[model samples]
Target: MSDKLTPEKRSWNMSRIKGMDTKIEVEVRKYLFSKGYRFRKNDKRYPGKPDIVLPKYHVAIFVHGCFWHRHEGCKDATTPKTRTEFWLEKFDKNVKNDQIKQEKLKEMGWKVIVIWECELKKDFQRIMDRLEQEFKK
Candidate 1:
């Protein structure tokens, strides 16, 4: 199917999408800070520039949007009807990169945590509790 928006409009919309300091990322950061969990945001020294880095716990957290990160079985992970192949390839690359980056972090002895956007929407409190437990461990 063809795109509903004009090409120029679509490009403009895509350009407006933020790559860093997204809404979900900020929310997680605020929660961690309020709980006294000191962290660095998008530390460039890390493999994937993790959204949150807890140096004390040696942990790296990635706040991923379900659609962009291609969260498996997630309702929000629908592909665009237009340019199906391009979107598929992009999603595949994102998933692969995530795995590679997480693996590298683990090899460096850092605990990696991925927080999906949908999970935060569905059960924010539960996810935060689990995150706290990870730090405690």
Candidate 2:
């Protein structure tokens, strides 16, 4: 096995992270709120506990981090030079889980909106438009 961050250090690093209410989450929430859209925050009752939930619109939003969610072509999604196998495995599992969650949410009749961290810079407006479309549907 490759050696980089020790198990203890990795645990600490991961532990310090927050799954929800992150910077991107806050920004998206604020933007949606500014547009007069109101919703729930991380309702565990839902399949993925979406970042923002518009139950009336049957829409669930997930603000995904590029690094964690492994967004393709994302600058923030660089793999570590060390412990390559471990990091790749972790990212692969994350991607798989995301797919499962989206499928489950869709099966429940919820329209899923995935906002990637990189997309936030270049496609924020497009994301909003898609969300609006979902609301209209």
Candidate 3:
């Protein structure tokens, strides 16, 4: 299938897509704050610059968009029909980078947590509850 928007328009739209401080990231931050958990947002010291870092618990949280991170078995992880090869390669790189970053963080003695966008939309409370439990461990 062809792209509906003009090349320029598509470029603009893609440019507007944020890398940090995204809506989902904000929501997760708010939840943690409300629960009295303090955290650092996108600390450059960490690999991948995790969305939320709770130094107190030595935990790093990544709130990932299923599409961008290529969440396996997720419907949102659909590929763009216009650039199948390009998108696939880009997504593959993202997945590999994520794994590398998470492994590095783990080796540094930090507990890593990945929160999918779909999980937040489907069950915000449940995901937050699980996050709290991780802190307790």
Candidate 4:
């Protein structure tokens, strides 16, 4: 099936999608900041360039989009109507890469935190609760 958008339009739309400081990322950052959490954003020294890196706490937080990350059991992770095959391949790769990053971080003695977009919209309080616990630990 042909793409509905013109090639130029499609390119423009894709370009507008940012690689960092996305909505969910910013939201998490703001919340963490308000709670007196100091963090570095997208620190390249770490695997996956995690959205927030709290060196003092040895914690790296990743704010992932459900669709892009293929969040398991998340409603927003559904495949797009178009380019089903391509999306599947892309999402599978994303999941695999995420796992590798997490493992590397763990091996390096860092605690990894992944907050999905769907969870942000639904169980935000739960996310905070868990973060608080992690911080205490």
Return the top candidate by lDDT. 3
**Cα lDDT for residue 123, model 3?**
96
Worst 10 residues of 2 by lDDT: 1-10
lDDT of 4 by residue, 22-82 (tens): 9878988899999899999999999999999999999999999988898888788888768
Clashing pairs in 1: none
- Per-model lDDT: 0.96, 0.88, 0.96, 0.90
Q: Which model, 1 or 2, shows the larger lDDT?
A: 1
Query: Which pairs clash (backbone N, Cα, C closer than 3 Å) in model 4?
Result: none
List candidate 3 segments past 4 Å from native: none
TM-score, model 4 to reference: 0.91
On the 0 to 100 scale, the lDDT of residue 61 in model 3 is 100
TM-score leader? 3
How far is 39's C-alpha from truth in model 3 (Å)? 0.6
- Per-model TM-score versus the true fold: 0.98, 0.84, 0.98, 0.91
Candidate 3 residues 26-48, lDDT tens each? 99999999989999999999999
User: Per-residue alpha-carbon lDDT of model 1 for 13-58, expressed as tens digits?
Assistant: 9999999999989999999899988999999999999999999999
As a whole number from 0 to 100, the lDDT of residue 69 in candidate 3 is 99
Q: lDDT value for candidate 1?
A: 0.96
lDDT of 2 at 40: 98
